[model samples]
Target: MKVRVGFGYDVHALVPERDLWLGGVKIEHTMGLQGHSDADVLIHAICDALLGAANMRDIGYHFPDTAGEYKDIDSKILLFDTMELLRDAGYTLGNIDATVAAERPKLNPHIPEMKRVMADVLQVDVEDISIKATTTEKLGFTGRQEGIAAYATVLIQK
Candidate 1:
C-alpha cells in the first residue's frame, strides 16, 4: 500500500454576530471567525490536509470564495466532499491529528464533541481523528482573541 501524509493550516479573523464553529460543533462564543463560508477553520484545515494528501490541491481550489454557492455554506459539506474526492482517487484515510488555536471560550472542554461530530461527518471511527486545542500564550492573533487558527495533519493510503 502506498501511504502519504499531508498538512494543512487555516486562520480567520474574529467578528461579531457570527457563530463559532469548530470541528463541526457549534460553540458558544462572543466572537466568531469571519469568512465567506461558515468560517469553520478546523474543518477547512482538515479539508485542505485531505486534499493535499491526495495531491488534489487545496480547498480554495475546489471551493472558491468567489463562488456564490459556497457563500455562507456549511464547512462540513466541504469536508465530506473532500473525503469523497479522495475515495474516488483510490485513497483511504489512515488517521488525522488536528489542533485549533484560540484564546477564549476554552476549547479543551469541547474536544470530545468536536471529535464525535467530525468523525460522523467523515464517516470514520472517532479513534482515527484526534482533535486538540491550545492557546498561543497571548503571543499571536489567536491569543489576543483577534482570530482563530487551526492546523491539521493527515495520513492516507491507497
Candidate 2:
C-alpha cells in the first residue's frame, strides 16, 4: 500500500452576532468565526489535510470563496465533497489528528461530538479521527479570544 501524509492549518476572526461552528458542531461563545462559509476552522483544516495527502490541491482550490455558492455554506457539505475528491483520486483515509486553539467556550467538552460528526461525514470509523483542543495559554489571537485556529494532520493510503 502507498501511504502519504499531509498537514493543514486555518484561522478565522471572531466577531459578534454569528454562531461559532468548529469541527462540524456549534459551540456557545460570545463571538463566532467570520468567513464566507460557516467558518468551521477544524473542518476546513481537515479538508485541506486530506486533499493534500491525495495531492489533489486544497479546499479553497476546489471551493472558491469568491463564488457565491460558498457564502454562508455549511462546512459539512464541503467536507463531504472533499472526501469524494480524495476517493476519486484512489486515496483512502488512514487517520487524522487535529487540534483547535481557542481561549474560550471550552473546546474539550465538545470534542467527542466533533469527532463523531467528522467520522460520519468522512464515512470512516470514529477511531480514525482524533480531535484535540488547547487554549494557547492566552498568548495569540486565539488566546486573546479574537479568533479560532485549527491544525490538522492526516495519513492516507492507496
Candidate 3:
C-alpha cells in the first residue's frame, strides 16, 4: 500500500448579505465568507488536501473561479467532485483532520453537523473525518472578524 499526506489552507473575507458556509453546513452568522463559490473555506481546504495527497493539482486547477459555472456553486458539489478525482486515480481516503478559525458565531456548536455532512460528501465514515473550530484570540483577520480561515490535512492510500 502506498500512503501519502497533504495539507491545505484557505481564507475568505467576511461580507454581509451572504450565508456563512463551512464544511458543507450553513451556520447562522452576521457575515459570510466571500468567494466565487459559496465560499466554504473548510471544504475548499479539504478538497485541496485530497488533491495534494493524490499528487493531483489543487482545487482551483480543477474548478476555476473564472468559470461562470462555479459562481455561487455549492462547495459540497466540489467536495464530491474532488472525491471522484481521487477515486479515478485509485486513491482512497485514510483520514482527514480539519480546523476552522473564526471570531464570531461560535463554530463549536456546529462542528458535529459539519463533520457528518462532509463525511457524507466524501463517502467516508464520520469517524474518518474530524472537524475542529477555534478563535484566533483577536490577533489577525479572523480574530478581528474580518474573515474566516480553514486548514486541512489528509491521508490517502492506494
Looking at model 3, residue 112 earns an lDDT score of 91
Q: What does candidate 2's lDDT look like per residue over 2-120, in tens digits?
A: 99999999999999999999989988888899999999999999999998888888999999999999999999999999999889888999999999988898888899999999899
Candidate 1: residue pairs that collide: none
Overall lDDT per candidate, in order of appearance:
0.94, 0.93, 0.94
Badly placed stretches (over 4 Å) of model 2 are none
lDDT of predicted model 2: 0.93
lDDT of 3 at 94: 97
Clashes of 2: 0
TM-score of 3: 0.99
lDDT for model 1, please: 0.94
Q: Enumerate clash totals for all models, in the order shown.
A: 0, 0, 0
In the range 58-105, model 3's lDDT, one tens digit per residue, is 999999999999999999999999999999999999999999999997
The residue pairs found clashing in candidate 3 are none
Relative to the true structure, candidate 2 reaches a TM of 0.98
